[model samples]
Every structure is written in C-alpha cells, then in structure tokens.
Target: MTRQLVAATKALLVLTLVCGVGYPGAVLLVAQLVPGRAAGQPVLVDGREVGSHLLGQPAGGPGWFQGRPSASDASGELSGGSNLGPSNPDLAAVVADRAASLRAANPDAAAAIPPDALTASASGLDPDISPAYALWQVPRIAKVRGLDESAVRRIVAAHVEDAPLGMLGQPRVNVLALNVALDARTAGEE
Candidate 1:
C-alpha cells in the first residue's frame, strides 16, 4: 500500500509540472513569437492605437457602417452575449427596437434588414459583420460621406475578407477596417 501511494504521488507531481507549468510556459513563448498578436493586433490610425482588430467599437453615426448590436455595448471588460434564447420576450423586444431604428436610419436601404443587423453576435466583441449586413448600410454611408453609392460599395467590396482557408466560415467585413478605408477614401477625394 505504501509503495502504491508513493507512486501515485510521484505521478501527480509530474503531471502537474508538465501539464500545468510547462504547457502554459510553452504556449506563452509560442504566442510571443507572432508579431502583434500578443497585444490583440491593434488597429492604428495616424500612428496612434485606435482599437484592437479583434474587438468592436460603438458606431459613430449613420455615416459609418455598424456591426451587430453589442450586448455588452462593446465594453471590453464586460464581453459576453445577452444569454437570451430565441423567443425570449426580452430578446424579441430588443430585436424589434433595433429593427425599427435600422429602418429609420436607413430608409433608402432596400434590402431586408439582415439578421446580423438586429442580433448581437455570440461574442459581444465580434469585430466583423456579414457582407450582407455591411452592404445594407451602404446607401446611408454613401449619402452621409457625400460619395456615390457605387464608390462606397466598392470600398466595402475591397475590404471584404474571405473565410479562412476558404471553408472555415462565411465571408465577413471587419467594421473597423471598412470605416478606416472609407475615411481614407473620403480624405483623398477632398
């Protein structure tokens, strides 16, 4: 019995050191090897950090394309979904309100409001929106930015990112990248 207990103790210590300490240390080392990844791959403007490409920010106005409704209101510290299932009354009411607002803001947008426009992503911090959702806001963006709708659509088109390796997920537009491109295009036109 004593011999068995000694062997078990040794196994426990070995597993703890290898799985707990060594694995995490190796992970940190591997992560640090990537450029800008350890810091969330910051999005920069004018040499200043604007935000992280992995996180969402509040929409500026009708001129800017919006991402999904952020359940935590895009708060990095409170990143989470609303936790409300479909058919939950509270969720329904919120979606209704969001739909109404989208209609009011985008009266010229002929497409049906995309699901992404009314619903928050599973991660409240999702930085990307479906291509459909981004295009739906094009008319409003074009009008507000004083660019032709086709020009704004082209900018959105240029920024669309294909799914990873061509199969992992659907195409998406990173809202920050899209808005930055819009600002750059607008500045150049002036």
Candidate 2:
C-alpha cells in the first residue's frame, strides 16, 4: 500500500509540473515570438489605438460599412458562433431580420444581400467582411458621408486585400481598416 501511494504521488507531481507549469510556459514563449498577432493586431490612428484589425466591432450607422453579425457581440473574450445550424428556425428568423434591417438602411443599394452580412461568422469576432458586402453598403455610406458613389467604390476597391497565397481564403477587407481609411478621407474633405 505504501509503495503504491508513493508511486501515485510521484506521478501526480510530475504531471502537474508538466501540464500546469511547463506547458503554459512554452505557450507563452511561442506567443511572445509573434507579438503583434498575439496582441490582436491593433489598428492605430494618429498613433492612438482605435481598434483591432483582428476583432470585429459594431460600427453601425449609414456612414459606415458594417461587419458581420456577431453572435458574441464582437467580444473577443467571449468569441464563438451561435452554433445555430442553417435549418434552425431561430437562425432563420435572425437572418430574415438582418436582411430587413439591411434593406431599410440601404434602400438605395442595388446589390443582393451578401451571406456574410446575414450569418454570424464561426468565430463571431471575425474582423472582416466580404468585398461584396462592403460594396453592397457603398451606396449608403456614400450617401450619408456625402461622398461620390464612385469615390466610395474606389476606396473599397483599394482596400480589398488579396487572398493569402492567391488561394487560401477569399479576398477580404478588414472592417476597422476600411473604416479608418474612410475616416481619413472624410477628414481630408473637412
């Protein structure tokens, strides 16, 4: 009995040290190697932090192009999808409501509602919206900001980041980056 107890205690101590201390320490070291990414890739304006390009935020209003609906309310700490499947009536209802709101906000917009605009992304904190979605909101943003439609379109076009390695993911625009660029353009006009 004594021998078994001693062996069990020894195994417990070793596992605790490895899992609770060594594993965490190693993870911390690796995260330090990529500080900016691990720090959420903060977006800066005039040297002051405005937001992060890595996390989506609620930037509603006709003057701005919005990001995807966030099931987590864009909270990085609580980031996750709603886990509602496509066939779920609750999800369907939310999508319908989102579509209605989009139509009301952008009555002048001619583009069909983009899927990203209706469904919350899996991470719920995704910082980007599809170019289609961004362009779809161009008319409304232009009208509200009192800028020409072509100018808003040009800005959106300029910010369209190419897919990684030309194939990995879809072309995307960071909502915070796009909004910051818009702000800069708007400031230039003032």
Estimate, for each residue in 11-36, the C-alpha lDDT of model 2 and write its tens digit: 99999999999999999899999999
Which candidate's TM-score is highest?
2
Worst-scoring 10-residue span by lDDT in model 2: 53-62
> All candidates' TM-scores?
0.87, 0.90
Clash count, candidate 1: 0
Q: Give Cα distance to truth, residue 149, candidate 1, Å.
A: 0.7
Would you list the C-alpha lDDT of every candidate in the order shown?
A: 0.92, 0.91
* Cα displacement (Å) at residue 39, model 1: 2.1
Instruction: Give RMSD (Å) of candidate 1 vs. truth.
Output: 2.7
lDDT of 1 by residue, 1-190 (tens): 9999999999999999999999999998998898688889998999988788888988788889888899899998998999999979999999999999999999999989999999998879999999999999999999998999999989989999999999999999999999888989999999
TM-score (C-alpha) between model 2 and the true structure? 0.90
What clash pairs does model 1 have? Answer: none
lDDT over C-alpha atoms for residue 34 of model 1:
88
Top model number, lDDT: 1
